[model samples]
Target: MATLAAECDRFKIDVIGISEVRWNGTGEFTNQKGGVLMYSGMPDEQDPHIRGVAVYVRKNVKHSILCWKAISERIIVVRFRAKKFNMSLVQCYAPTEDSPLDQKEVFYSALERTLSEIPRTDVIILMSDFNAEITQSIELGSLFPHKTCHKVTWKSPAGNFESQIDHICISKRWSKVLCDVRNKRSADIDSDHYLVVAELKFNIPKHRYEHPQHTRRTYNTTKLNVGAVKNEMIERINNVSLMEDASIEETWLHIKTNLEEICKDTLGYRKNEQKEWLSANSWELIAQRRSLSRQIKKAVKSDKRNYYVELSMKAQAASEKGDMKELFKLTKQLGGISFQSSAPIENENGQLVFAKNEQAEVWKRHFEKTLNIIHNESGELTIPRHLNPNRQIDTRAPSVNEIRGVIISMKSGKAP
Candidate 1:
């Protein structure tokens, strides 16, 4: 699986449809590198793993996946959000040509039904092992001519017989997007079939308007806790010269810029540290224990047990110390919890809004309709005249003392 992922990465493939997964049960899992693998196979209770199909999407492109359905062990379908038009991919491990006619008919009938269910506006791509040879077709045609080796998708063990059984077919409307389709013999998966790669000239449209993100530097303010650093900062501020005749704004800006420069020069930027639930020592112990377990030795077993006890002690110590962050992370890991990034939201028309500007527009429209109230009739509120007419309401501006009193009474740590 790792090798396959590496191959995909090498080729910079974002989406890959795999045939003959041969895994029991249908499910999905994020790999160590964050790539997602969605597979469909026979139920766990039913043994003797046979035909199966799957789709592997790169981590970067995982956000584009809208939904996926495991139709059967032989077929799976995944829908992806694309620019201009969405796309639906159907992966199949079709019955061999030599299989019974009934079986072949059932496979094709199911595929037909699946295709029918997909929206006609989608750019449908059907790929993987079809188990049939196509000499020529009017509706479907190969875009590029390659060497015979690059044309054959599968080969016999003896290296005598070879044919292009696997295929990647796209909707006629999107045929122009496909640049090339050929077999890649370099990808070695220890299978008789070679990897079939297809190139598509897809333009992932950006948001209509994107707010430019500016990276801000974070100074290590913690250094201020040190008496020397605090004194240095004060000394630098005292040494700064202010223009006596400059405007208030100009003077403030000069001081602000100088302070920032002094802090940057003295404190430097904070370094980001990658936090993990377990300590480095604990991870090292775990690696050593794993290495020892591979060897069949009584001494090694005893050492591994010792390492386990040490790891348990470390975890217990963390619990006693009330390290909530580490505890929660460890709990999630034990519970097999995986966190995924949020996907794009749908709009009023039930279509996904992927662009940031478009999403903002949708939100704007939603709030406008939700908050705006239309009143059929207006009612006037009548307040009785001031009860204490003799004590006239003060209409004069507040004095400096009154303003200072109000300022003193106000709470700190609040926005002005």
Candidate 2:
């Protein structure tokens, strides 16, 4: 978790979808480095940790997490409340091609159900280690396979077989946000599967408040703690007129203008961070591979083609040799675990609400009626025989040890 968080920080990645985590049980935890890691796996203690899924979100993105559901060992989902719309990320590990047809069908059915739960307006990104080539089936459009030069994601130990099993799919509604998707073979993740990433362009909407839209302005309130800033703010506030006869609108306008001015002059504005994870060596190797691939695609002479293939095989072997402790830790954390549970709710009319929106409304109404209902029959109110309004409360300051002990009592790995 620490190594992955460091990599994400270096890459400036907001969120990463992961599969084949092989963990046992579902959990949300903050790693030692502060990034959020949420995972879902089998609940049974005896089951092997062969399949699991997770999402590692950077601190900035972690605050936006709305909810997460562990559907099964094969699937896990995390939903983020984005500015413009909700973003649903689904990570999956599907049955291998050699597995029974019924198992494959069951996995596909679960995946479909998961996808169906997401609202049409939300942005959906489906990432999976499918273990088989994908075909155009549902509205989720395949992105990486069609864009990369060497589309294969996995290579055999003998270097005799190459197949593309891992894939990324985006909702048809969000197809325009996709800039590109490619297989990063040079990524040294110490896995048989290469890293497949999709470049997306999303403009998060500004936060809206109850104030008049035209009169409102966003500010960096974080600077208020600086001594100089605080002094400046005090001076500015002191200089504002505050006559007793002043109209409410006039007073509000003055306050608003002062805040905007201070924010503009002192706190400044925020800038968007860019994401670019490739290291120098990785780029160089990728360029060489791409050129060789293009040359081969052009049907060059047999000798030249053979040379290109040999070089490509050597490069693939070198990539396979890279060691990543984090990858191994992920697998170990996933070893031997299984669990399962589900809940289905009914609507106000006693009919099941299959649609998400309807189900939400049904629950809202149920809670409102259940919690707010007033009883027609009344019961006698009893008061305590003895009461004291002037009871003294403890006012002594806490010692350093006492404060430390209180802090130590707080649970680690739990969300704030």
Candidate 3:
């Protein structure tokens, strides 16, 4: 029991949903430390041995128990938010005896009610030791092909069946199976049967919507704005620390991981003395820190003002010189802005919306605009001077001398 408590402490699990927490009137089990622990089947059942279900939620998560019920002698329903994704995680110990279909109906009904009671957005993770058979025909599809647990929960020394009954179910809205989320059967701890544990992965509510509509460094201009961006990246690096060293990639490759974390923060970073330990010299730590710092740099620059200011000079220069290449490059760089091919914004009104497309298309449109501007500004256009005079040159070409002048003019346009 002490070891279990220490494991829970080491993991920092937000909710420890335990089934069959056998309680005694005078044992140390009376003391529920670290979080709110709710144990059922106490005084009323005349069983001080609270045998059925229990849940311990960490204090900082800010959850009010939305609903709690003992739907079956072996099953319990709990609805709470592990940071806004309100989930209904049931603690079930399936009936040992071959109960009638009528009992199964009640268990299934409770599951249905539990799903309806919680927000659909919040996922349902049904975790239990279901001694009944886990057939493909069984209602739960989400927990299919129970990896490492393709065996029956009940073992009479003969080891008769190999179909998984102990399972965990996830609502379609809450999660999907990835290589990471897993559990395996283990020698039962403090019980006769083997134990099955699941590592469930849920989308943290604050992290789901990560992409910023606009990402300018500061709404206001000051060094503090820069710090705010830097701080946000710092927070991302902090989040990565929670993950095991093997699962994560090198710093640059995992920039998007920090993007979501960066978006969750009001300041975009966490502050601690550890951040101060980040060495400018070590590439490993530097890259890790820099990944987050890049997020801050972007947040600082992700505003309309900073965005426009950064592009203002380029936009004007592109407009003046009629160099489609540089103008297009500028447009490519400014990811979430609209621009026009002609000096008049109206010409490029619909043309200048932000969507992620290939680099070639960006350059293609940029040159098209540049060519158009060059055509309009110089009052001339250029093409291959073909003496063959093919019909492909559908329009008349300006005199070579005039076209040369236009080219020369644009080439010289970049000089201060």
Candidate 4:
């Protein structure tokens, strides 16, 4: 099973069906490389692994698996959700030609009923190692007409006979999805039957969270303490047109424009930070593991096989329980295990702003109003002792440190 999974990984197969996997009982287990393997065997504990069928789906695509069932020792059905439509994958191992007709009939009957049970609207892909030759006139007929250089699947042990017994059939509704199906004779898996690969063209849906896009701005607040930058910002703000009788909106716009221009010239902009959890060393180890796995499959001598096995184990161990750096990389590779919904925000009017643009605009108004407030209503007020008494509040120019501290105290990367 491990070797089979390694081959699947080597071939980059999204999903594969296995036949005659003489395992005892029906169950699912995770392979070393994280692929999902579901198999069905004899119902009784006393029975052996004969005629067992299984399906191995790659880790990346396993999340789309809706459900799976082990119908019998010879058949197992798995269903998956795709972008445009649902899909049902049926895998089976049919009785051999030498088997009794009644047994063959029972297998066919079960297979037919299984196919019938799947939703007619969903795309169906039926893959099986049917010991009966499809080339025989009484079988699937022209549905799988042979082409040159690929007339047979199973070769006799004596290298004398060959026949096309394995088959992959799709529902007529999804016939257009079939890109190509061919027998890969070069894949020598030590079995008389060659590997049959089928490629189907269908889009896989990418699930995403509907989160509001934030208009986060990054400012070089740390640069405000520089004497030259501080002086320049002050000079620019002092030159702004007050338009004494201008409406509140006009004055507000002028102040906003001047501040933005000065900040842009002095502070500059902040860049978006990219999250990198995976390290380079972890990726290299992964590549080495895959390479060693392929070599193990081809190694004939016991010593060479053992050498490859040890190397592969080292790679796997380095990936699993190695340094935090490598473990983080592996964790990043297995992404989206957790789901987090977007946080809600309150707008200027105390109403929630969930829409992307609306939220951004509301935040802008909020900061502008907050920063421009001259005095807080709850704070101590400077009032004249009498109606005629005059009062003046003394003010001093802010030092570079004070100016920089004010900017630093504000949200690090937030913009008004």
Candidate 5:
């Protein structure tokens, strides 16, 4: 997934649809590089992993996503908020023509229902493996003139036959925005199908309203451990001037300002430090492979193949030597998979809340309802005179010596 995302980034593509995901279940997650991958697969645990569909949107495009639905393993739809009219993308994995008629009917019936649910004003883009060849349709067909090689999307195992099974169809109302559609054969992902790319001449407008992001400044508090720094801070605080007849609030404001100024001058902000794990040699190999990937000649393909073999060997060697850190890093880089935090929580109406302020509001309402309970059956209890204690407890503040003893008994090197 990471490798595919990197390829999309290289081509400057904001969104891409994928078929045959084959992963179990349906959900969405963000990759380490910040790209969002929303996939739908077989919902049943007993079902075989097959015919899954997914859509990947780049980091910048993710903010515009309004909502998404996982209809089934072979169908998924994602809606995006756009400039004039919102855009809806439906990715599908249709059954082949040779499949049973009933199976094909089921797929088309579900697809029709999904399309009907979308608003008519939306500009829908239906894409991915349809497994059918049609010369005409309501959706705009590929009209750009290109070589036969650029039109073929899939090849037979023996490399004797080729076909264009994958396609990208846009609503006729907005068909003028589609500039061209072509197949890119140089993109090698160990699949018989080539990468189908579409060029659209349109702009995605900025969000309606953007919340200002406030970044909290973090000071290097460890500097306070230095004797000179500590002394300078204390001296600055002691030298602060205050009005003799100032109110309590005014005095507190003056002291707070002085303390903040002292801290800013003495302690600098902390910087985020990250380690570079890849060695120089690995980077060189990666660069060479990337350069070779752009060419479709036989010699370049052989060189790229050799590079993959070498990288695989290096990974095996690292595993044998028990260098788990390097092994894990290599695996993430080569296997095209990375870890993500988790999915966002849904609101009361089952809609996802992405903004921090909205999420806080949801939590606030939850706590208010949960913690404030009204009692329906309540009565005052009477105390029994026979159960009362015989001795009277003293109700006096502790003396200075007792307070000192209590403080001394507490453990050291801990926060109060």
Candidate 6:
């Protein structure tokens, strides 16, 4: 298991799943690089030996365990948290020739029921050693033939033939594959059966709290008639009989190179379209949003004008009365009000009254509060009917837009 694990490590897999583990431990170990979020089955409290499935998460990834349940002697379901959303993972060790068919049916039924209860939206990855030979056949002589199933994951006692006993499967919602997927015999160490590893890149649902661990991706821009471009590429690939003669690597490499060339041409067409769009309307839209933002800023700045006016009056009166203490306080307050700058979050109400040097520690908090108030008092944030379920706002951005509308209505003659 350790040697096979090292082979897996070379692939830089985020998670490693083991079936028929016979351990109750969650499989968490600090030494595991990506923070192993492992869980093995021991559903029945009466049974002591784990005797089910287990997982190991790399120590680097942040995660939390949601739930773990053992459906049978071989099937286990484990749910865990990764960032904002919860993910469910199932590992099954189905009964083979040794175990009765009745047991397999019972276990599969329970497994099916357990899986059905889970909603389709959740990110799920189901894998296991389903000892049964999975057939790719359908009813009758099927016109739409199923892809041939390759069976060579488990080795026989004589070490001559390997059967497709070990397996990994996934749900339709989280359906992602790493191009070619097949059984790898190089990972067989001591566990009698060769470990089945498949490289899958899943597309998770877009959520506010969830973020990608991978680097930022740049999308390939499409041509003016994008659908036509895609069809053309498909046609070009079909023209070549590369698959029949060339190695899989060579065939895929040729396809990728052609794809890049086609995408590059499409990108050129896209750039021209963007230029035309800007020429037609984007400049005006940019000016409009900016103008509204400017109007909002101006209204906020004027509020501080009154504060400055009051402070000036106080300073003048104190100077005339020979009260240096009052004059200094007034001057400092006025000076504080004079200096303002942009911070992490843009201020909604232009009034960022700089605190005096003595009050520097509270500058950001005080300014933020003032900005929120200004935003609340003004009507700046509005969502149009066409833009329902808008993209998420930056956490640092002021969100008092909704409240500001109410404040404005009340301040104007419209309050009921």
For model 2, residues 180-238, the per-residue Cα lDDT tens digits are 77666645445667666678887544334355555545567688889898788788767
**Poorest 10 consecutive residues of model 2 by lDDT?**
135-144
Model 3's number of clashes is 15
**What lDDT does candidate 6 reach at residue 244?**
73
Compose the digit string of candidate 1's lDDT tens values, residues 1-416: 76677678888888899998899889998776678999999877467888989999987788788899999888999998887888899999999868999998888999999999999999999996988765432122366877776788888997657777899999998899999998877675568898999898875433243353555658999999999999998999899999899999999999999988999988988976645445678657654654564453567668877866765666677799987666655555455445453457788899987667999999899977666544444654333343333665688999999999989988654465
> Could you tell me which 10 consecutive residues in candidate 4 have the lowest summed lDDT?
134-143
lDDT of 4 by residue, 146-251 (tens): 5744646678897656777888889887898998777776554457787888878987654453454455577888888899888888888788878788999989
Report how far off residue 202 is in candidate 2 (Å). Answer: 1.6
> For every model shown, what is its TM-score relative to the native structure?
0.49, 0.48, 0.38, 0.48, 0.58, 0.40
Winner by lDDT: 5
Model 6 agreement with the true structure over 47-139: per-residue lDDT tens digits? 788456666655334345566665655666667665455678777777766778797678889888978977566677777777764332322
> How many Å off is the CA of 192 in candidate 1?
1.0
Taking the tens digit of each residue's C-alpha lDDT, what string does model 5 give over 86-184?
Answer: 899999999997899999999999999999999999989999799875432122245888887898788899775677789999899899989999987
TM-score of 5: 0.58
Each candidate: RMSD: 38.1, 32.3, 31.8, 44.2, 36.3, 32.3
Clashing pairs in 2: 22-334, 23-334, 42-338, 42-339, 43-338, 43-339, 44-338, 44-339, 49-336
Tell me the whole-model lDDT of each prediction, alpha carbons only.
0.80, 0.72, 0.54, 0.77, 0.82, 0.59
RMSD of 3: 31.8
lDDT for position 164 in model 6: 61
Q: For model 3, how does the per-residue alpha-carbon lDDT over 36-66 read when each residue is reduced to its tens digit? A: 5665543344565645666665544424556
